[model samples]
Target: MNPVTAYRFITANQFAVVGASTDRSKYGNRVLRWYQAHELPVIPVNHKEATVESVPAIASIEEIDDPANAAISIITPPKVTLGVLKKAKELGIQKIWLQPGAEDKAVLDYAREAGLDIIAGGPCILVQGPSLLTHRANL
Candidate 1:
């Protein structure tokens, strides 16, 4: 993993928390809450909902008007995550963080093959979020 890429990913201001939910106990909800708590510009991507944690949830990455400038943190099932990865690549989203349980060999391979900056393999956003907030603040 490129240190620069990870740094860029962790420090990006605009983001989309794909698979976000309203249920506070879910990791999806926690991730969204972390972004909101930090006062960042974050879009909640959830096809089944109108909104998530007060932010209007978008159905897909293609729906985002400026996806290229934003990084994404995904917390969905493996199959859904694969589709999101494909769309993220298609939309030129440079960075992605896959929350624990969202990864698989195929997804990791695609991210590498697509040349995306990714955070995976068990370092969850909910754990790293405070550090990311500090990194963002210093930027």
Candidate 2:
């Protein structure tokens, strides 16, 4: 899909950062920050109870109360992405932003097979996010 379409999908949803970490140095953390800065409702998904950037860090996708119109921003290891995708499917999430390095061809195929609408490997969230903001401002 085009960047505009992808941005619309993200901004219109209750977004979740699935691979969000407690570590400040990771891209997941940066994504969480970007979402927060944009005033997006972003749930940080991590195994740790510790909060990241002041957002409550959830341990799993199943824990989210409102999965309706939820989009998951995935930035986890490739090995773990399938499990996340599976959980997303189970929870009825449709949109997913699979960060670069978070998935391989197999994972991509799997996501497609699972019928998830995904945005992957084109631009990082930091770039797409700002571009989206600009697009909205111009409108």
In lDDT terms, which candidate is top? 1
Tens digits of per-residue lDDT for model 2, 84-117: 9888888887778888889998789898798777
In angstroms, the error of model 2 at 29 is 0.7
Off by over 4 Å in 2: 1-8, 134-139
Q: For candidate 1, which ten residues in a row score worst on lDDT?
A: 128-137
> Which residue ranges in model 1 land beyond 4 Å of their true spot?
none
Candidate 1 local lDDT, 1-139, one digit each (tens): 3557667887775889898988999999999998888788899988899999888999887887777778899999988899999988888888888889898999899888988778888578777666656667678
> What TM-score does model 1 achieve against the real structure?
0.92
- State every prediction's TM-score relative to the real structure: 0.92, 0.87
Residue pairs that clash (backbone atoms under 3 angstroms), model 1:
none
**Measured by C-alpha RMSD in angstroms, how accurate is candidate 2?**
2.2
